[model samples]
Target: MGGGVLGTMHAWQAVLRGHEVIHLEREPEARGASVRNFGLVWVSGRADGEELETALRARELWAGLGERVPGLGFRANGSLTVLRTEAELAVAEVFAAGPDAAARGTRLVDPAEARTVNPALRGAFLGALWCERDAAVEPRVAQPALRAHLAATGRYTWLPGREVREVDARGVRDDHGDHHHADVVLLCTGAALSGLVREIAGPVPVRRVRLQMMQTEPLDEPLTTSVADGDSLRYYPAYRGVELDALNANQPQPAVAAEHAMQLLMVQRADGGLTVGDTHGYDEPFPFDVVEEPYQHLRQVAEAILGRPLPPVRRRWAGVYAQCRDTGQVVHRQRVADNAWLVTGPGGRGMTCSPAIAERTVEEIGL
Candidate 1:
């Protein structure tokens, strides 16, 4: 019943494979973690070497999808991880000095050199690790474009506001007392995964994690590229220098160093608006609470980093991403009944990670 990037991407993949598909979404409008995200089609944080080969291919797929689905809000602004401390600089050096630096387009640059690439960052930080391969898109703009493409595909059959209750070996049962049958079935429900679903797939260990994010009004000069702090190394998977054990032992400091927020500021839209602030927090089961105090903390950190109060708030929200314990992205196969299957759990990387994941799922089904 939870339909977002994973669900939609699977729908698109079905059409590509010449399989007739029916997409059921319970929500009147598709607005949640899937659309309310950084919208970054990222490859920088991909696992090292062979692990990244698939992510690299998905990067190209996003570009091709943009062409096919015009107004998909694709941008090639690239991403820069700014280093404010000597320790941060050393970490960036390690990444640049690593074996995959060339193909990843990662380089260490001095402050002055970074300003040349993003003039808005003039006199802002000590240095940055630039990755030209990363890009972004406007989620608000892209979702509708995707919907329209699916509508035009003729291969797609969408049933909005319809919630699926059960999926037996034969077909899917909805709340409206109807059942839709298909040769194969895939479940892309995010955060709502539980019960026998886990029993069926061994244990993918799905959990709903909420991220606090904020947006700003248009500014006079927008940053040409995305910017993040060295502390981001601890939070993002791409920064291999961050060890899981090391981070769990560490916590937010007395005044909230820019690192604790793991903030990645990106100048977005033609109007000069910027989207910033992302903090990860999790509870035992799952909490969908959207609070304001986190934004207050976020603003404090932004002021500390920018040396000034942030611009007027434009939009504010919280979204949940389904995570499968320590996995890059969750892709599972559940043989619910004889020959019938359920596939899901792509996690937060669904945007940059979905193209390849959907292709793999379709291939697995031989459709």
Candidate 2:
């Protein structure tokens, strides 16, 4: 029922299968985690097996969609996880040598090679772990562009600014007093977990995560690939090896970074501006204000990696998304009614795996 990436992708899958679709959005435009993210179709750091498979399939689907929808701005530029310390480099070595590392396109590059790949990164890092499967898209335009493409099919109808007030086995009723009926209904609500969702899902086994990020003015040069710091080793499941444990145990994160659960993921946009960020917050009663400490730490780490001062900050914001507490499950999907389903809690994997997730749903439900 929601119109974020997940919802839009579900609509795309259904309409492509010759099914009529009606998409609903609470906001005039999607301004949630979908738009607030790095537009990264990251496939490198996913957990092995099913999660990695989903990410890989989604990466291919994203490339295909980008070709059909020019506005998608998809790029197979890949990603580089910069390593500064010897410990971090050790972790990268282990990751590159793992059994599935070849499948993930994992490679280790020296500082010179890393710079050759992305000259914008002139920082003095030991080396970087390269993953060729990672990619990027223009999240700011993705949903609307997809919606526009779907609308051209004549079988898709978009209803924005319609907050679903009630949902039943037959259909859903919006706040505008309009009733829409469909054979199946999928609620792709992002982090809006209250009212109808709370009543139906009944204490979703998912937790909400809050994060802060910032964007800067266009840079003088391009960042050829998405970049991440060693801190990412702790956050991504793929790097949970003994080397990473040693690195984490030996080299604790800086106080400011640790305090905010910060990680440095930098990506250059189509316009040359850098999208950098992210500090994690999982507790309820999230702070109402964005603290400056995390931003300052991010700036320092970024400049050290780039070997240049970052451009002046142009925007700053915070976002929240539901993540499944059961790490084994990709997302929390429940049949709230005979024909109504609540699909959510993909966590940070939402953008990376939405297309594949929706495709699986269609297959399972025979939609």
Candidate 3:
């Protein structure tokens, strides 16, 4: 029952198609994976298969939405895939050599140029896979705007704090004993998909991956582009195979940071505060508690890369996502039955990929 990115994305596309869309959620507003995320609109840090096209198309949709829905954190600041190892560099190379990679604005960069773009990266990374077309948003600020836009759409009826208890062949029955109907029903439950949708019942291979992230106090300096390193690739399926294979293979032992699959993705806010993170955990039933180890690891990475410990952590927390079995990215038409569908398992690429997934869902329904 996430009314955050995917729900809003669905509402955006549905309204545009002149379809009446009722978005239901257990929370009054979105504060799940949509808000508890880096908000990096990553196009390149996506799977290299079918999602490539969806990401590309959704990118266009994001840009278009910016015209009417301003301040949705849709900045085109691009992304920098920091390469700290040979394997990471190799993955970047493959992405660059692959078809459509260049078009997506993925390019290999030298250390000098990389430093020129992000001075904080000095001496830490060898180079980076630069995605000049990527973008980011402040989740806190962006969610409000997205919510407002969806609300403004007359075709949209938001049912926040309303839990859907069951779904028969007809529609949904909520906890309040209120029944709502729709011609089609799509589950966007993130990690709770299996529990929410009975069709795919019983321990859907979706496991909850908890990640601890932190935001720094006001910084004198901030990285302009979003940045992630080898640990990021190993954890995020998007950048896993592209350029880091060789580097991951050579490491005699998994790097300590690798254990957490930690990566430093820094995004600067308008006020100069930087949001950085994150450490991955295969915590079952979703981890609401934030651990100190990840926070310590985050500091260590920042110190190693920037040659200094970052400012105080203004905010610290953990987020969870339902990871898919195969590609790790969510797919449309997950069920053969026309009305039933699955939209979870986005890994950490929800912000970048949700727009496309919602658009494709609209397309699939002939909206």
lDDT of each: 0.70, 0.92, 0.72
Q: Per TM-score, what order, best first? A: 2, 1, 3
The residue pairs that clash in candidate 3, if any, are 87-244, 87-246, 87-247, 88-244, 90-243, 91-242, 91-243, 91-244, 92-243
Off by over 4 Å in 2: none
* C-alpha lDDT (0 to 100) for residue 274 of candidate 1: 73
lDDT comparing candidate 1 with the true structure: 0.70
TM-score of each: 0.88, 0.99, 0.87
Worst-scoring 10-residue span by lDDT in model 1: 251-260
Query: What are the per-residue Cα lDDT tens digits for candidate 3 across 157-236?
Result: 87889887777677778889998887767667876654456555544555667888888887787777887655666655
Q: What is the lDDT of residue 353 in candidate 2?
A: 95
Model 1 agreement with the true structure over 1-367: per-residue lDDT tens digits: 3467777777888888787888888777676677778778777767764337766777788889987886887777788887776666666777787888888878888877887887766435677889898888777777667867988878777788877776777767888989988666777767666654554455665666677787888766767887665556766666655542343345333344342344545546656777776767666543556567667766765555455567898987777777766465445555666645665655557677777777777787787
Model 1: which residue pairs collide?
A: 45-238, 330-345
Highest lDDT: give the candidate number: 2
Q: In model 2, how large is the Cα lDDT of residue 120?
A: 87
Question: What's model 3's TM-score?
Answer: 0.87
Write the residue-wise lDDT of candidate 2 on 286-314 in tens digits: 99999998999999999999999999999
